[model samples]
Target: MATLGTVTFNNSSATSIFHTSSSLKFSSKPLLLPTRFSPKTPFPLRILRIYALSSNDIKVGTNLEVDGAPWRVLEFLHVKPGKGAAFVRTKMRNYITGNTVEKTFRAGSTIDEANVFKEAKQFTYKDGSQFVFMDLNTFEEIRLNEADVGDKTKWLKEGMDCNLLFWNGKVIDFELPITVQLAVVDVDPGLKGDTVSGGSKPATLDTGAVVNVPLFINIGDQILVDTRTGQYMNRA
Candidate 1:
């Protein structure tokens, strides 16, 4: 009975000591708890941290940070075999260089998540080699270098709305609409016998983008183009 009472007293004493105002108060400084307490003692401070993304959570359009570079998941497949462990196979594109690569990760592995965002901007004009875009809501102007515009320059036209990809608050890349309607600025006249399914002829659009259109297409004709593949869809 005495030993039972002693144990109860000690437990109550510990509770009182741990719950004191000074011990319970939080501070911005490093918090070190009393090691004398039991291994299961509750910590007075809670720390929040950012954990990497799990492979099982991956999906199409997922953004990741690899080797200090930003990548977007173009495609992903979760594969499981009878002989070995499961894994995820992914096709990702680098935001900066516009290069695509295949990557594999263990089923339960973790990957860093990239902080990327997009802003809507309108292509206002080209000042020398720099392309200028304006935020329609804010009217703020942003100029991108020629190299940053890359091959997309061929499809850009004034007043075209675009999505500018930003990482760490800086613009890294941009996306154009999948399809655009452009007028043919130059093309040879179609022969009399030309059919819609017949031979294709090269036609330059007002934006300087050259695409092969049906032989029936003529200068001043409006055509729909797939910006992703640079193919002519049909007359607009």
Candidate 2:
């Protein structure tokens, strides 16, 4: 019977085995392998912001970020006729206040867009010094301070829809409807034949808002008024 011995595969044992196999092998050289080259993945191209502007660059309906507020382009025109540098005439609406203002921008100019958030809500009621509004979509109610409501308080009526503008999650201003119906509380008695001359009379509404009504308007009459121009509309 032949006896078998266990063999271990180690560096020193391999060297000893190689030495014992020297008689059978001619050389003890190691084989060389080729090196690998990995190609890098290409990256996506990034888009750069463009802010090059000129005095003649003002366009109607252009959204502008100015003075840290977002404004909508209401009207704009470029003036450049046999003069110095051209100037841009613009009328913009404050996104938060719903107020319109006229401003001039350099013909070629770039401005940042005001980062503001806005939503439509229904005017609910006033709680002491705070005015409350409910979201039209979610029915969620929010309280706003008197400062945020500003002059809009005159136009705010229960159940009226308005736009609430926010800056960094803080209520800033409100946008009221252009026209609203209000009951006349007091007014100069209308004089007959005054309508022929298209005369106007000062009238006080139930909401405490004053408007110029037609000469025929009288107290206790319900009238529609243009909130923007403070002019009276037809009787309600």
Candidate 3:
């Protein structure tokens, strides 16, 4: 299969091929490719140029050049707000960091998108200072440092799925699944009549994540948890 711009080829050998084109032909969708931007640049910087823009005007979903990088606009809303200068409320996802950030732009204001890249990888195992992951599609293994994982490392488990963010082909960030279920390895036995008071107790899961479970729950129970909120879900 071959890809050209927004179109992709399903089967080169097959006589019939599907072509998916953008409704707004001029709008450029962001690409998950390596970029060359440093992390020291300030946010809300002006966009100087865009590879997809035909003219000088900025359009939603169009990649903008900012701080010598590219960024994709996930959403954009124009607001008048009854008074003051009109502005655009934009939710942009960093292509390299896989991080979504919100910013307000003055109406008619232009800025560059950071040139970032992303790739889907499967969690393999952890080394001393790095977490290893293998690209399922590419079968290529990559190692990311602890700093790149940030706070998401606590929730990562073996054979989990994760997204690797890259800049200039170097991993800079990653994202983990929002929730994971683990078995309760140990918990204090609940006392009789504890249910009447609506009491809760702390339990340790097999993954070592602590959850507040109902007093009736005992060791060897499985539970679901929301990693994003770090809250307990129903028994698994």
User: Global lDDT of each model?
Assistant: 0.80, 0.68, 0.63
lDDT tens string, model 3, 1-236?
32222222223211211134555232243323322334433222222222222212445665544445546777877788887988877777665566778777777643533345557789999889988898776566788787777667767789998776554435656667777877888889978887676878889887677878888778888777888887877788
Which ranges of candidate 1 are over 4 A from the true structure?
Answer: 1-52
Clashes of each: 0, 12, 13
Against the correct fold, how does model 2 do in TM-score?
Answer: 0.61
lDDT (Cα, 0-100) at 68 in candidate 2: 66
lDDT of 1 by residue, 100-218 (tens): 99999999876767767777899999999899998887677889999999999999999999999877446999999999999999999998779746799899999899999999989
lDDT of 2 by residue, 147-193 (tens): 77777677678989887765534566667888898888898888878
Give the higher-TM-score candidate: 1 or 2. 1
Model 2 CA deviation exceeding 4 Å by range: 1-57, 60-63, 67-75, 81-108, 191-197
Cα RMSD to the true fold for all candidates: 15.2, 23.8, 11.3
Worst 10 residues of 2 by lDDT: 40-49
